[model samples]
Target: MVGVLVATHGRLAEEFLNSAAMLVGEKEQMSSVCVLPGQSPEEFLELAEKKVEELDTGDGVLALVDIAGGTPNNTMFRLSMTHKIRILTGVNLPMVMYCVMERSDEMTMEELIEALLENGRNEISEFGKR
Candidate 1:
């Protein structure tokens, strides 16, 4: 199965996973990293790498970060050089739920990323209209 990693500043990463678990039960090959205020970039990168390794199950890993230019996203972008991983930004509850439900060994990383990119947008609107 493909692993899903949630890395974000503060506790957003942990909460996103927790919320998904509450709705979908516990999921395997999923991990979360909360980058604290005082955490060094090197330290954060190290922990992130460990999580990526733990989550990888031959299908490669998908990293869902809070934002594009943020630490979590940037670290994964850098790590992608040495690992088989894809990174996506603009994480939300809907995306987290999709990750929990759709992630699987049968799904290619490119397919997953494309689906999320498209689905993630459709999931949002003016609070009334599509």
Candidate 2:
């Protein structure tokens, strides 16, 4: 199985996971970490590492950050170089949902990433008549 980590500048990461979990029902498919409330990079990384470890099963890990160049993204980047981990930033609800919903025995991490990118790029129109 592919391990997942979600990190953001605030509690958004944690909150998003919580709500998603609530809606989708709890499963150990992915793990998430947050860098919020003035937590240090080391702490955030530690949390992320723990989450990764919790979800890791010899398969490689993947990280999703809320924004690029931010603390979470930078930390994931630094960690990725030393480990066989894939990091993707600029996370959104659709991306998260896509990742979780697409988790399956038939999907590889690479395929999942591609699906995530495709889903992330989709545009929605909310101005239609209600």
Candidate 3:
């Protein structure tokens, strides 16, 4: 299966992982990283690289970040050139649940990326305004 690294600013990454774990139990090849206040982007990048290396078990890693152009997202983008890492931004609980529950070991990298992009977009909607 593809490994997952939920990296974001503040404690959001950890919270997402915790919530997903509650729904599907703890998953293997999954981890979280947070960019705290006063933390340099360079330092965060190094930390993210190490986590990616640790999580990657030949299936590569899927990194979920809070937003595009942020430190978490930007670092993962940089790491992508050297590692088999695919990035997805705007992570939410539903997306995390999909990654934890539906991501299969047999799925290819392209398929996983496609599924995540679709699922992430589909999770958002205006429900109460009618």
| Cα RMSD, each candidate | 1.4, 2.2, 1.2
Residue lDDT tens for model 1, 1-119: 77889899999999998999999866788899878999999999999999999999788888999989999999999899999988989888888888778766688888889988888
TM-scores, all models, native as reference: 0.93, 0.86, 0.93
Per-residue alpha-carbon lDDT of candidate 3 for residues 68-107, written as tens digits (9 for 90 to 100): 9999999999999999999988988888888788888898
Off by over 4 Å in 3: none
Candidate achieving higher TM-score, 2 or 3: 3
What order do candidates take by lDDT, descending? 3, 1, 2
lDDT of all the models against the reference?
0.89, 0.76, 0.90
- Model 3 has an lDDT value of 0.90
Instruction: Report model 3's TM-score to 2 decimal places.
Output: 0.93
Least accurate 10 contiguous residues by lDDT in model 3: 21-30
lDDT-superior candidate, 1 or 3:
3
Candidate 2, residue 67: Cα displacement in angstroms equals 0.7
Candidate 3 at residue 54, lDDT?
A: 96
lDDT of 2 by residue, 1-130 (tens): 7777778877888777887777765446577777877688888788777777677676667788888899888887887776657888777777777666767766788987888777877734466759
Clashes of each: 0, 0, 0
Model 1, C-alpha of 31: deviation from truth (Å): 0.8
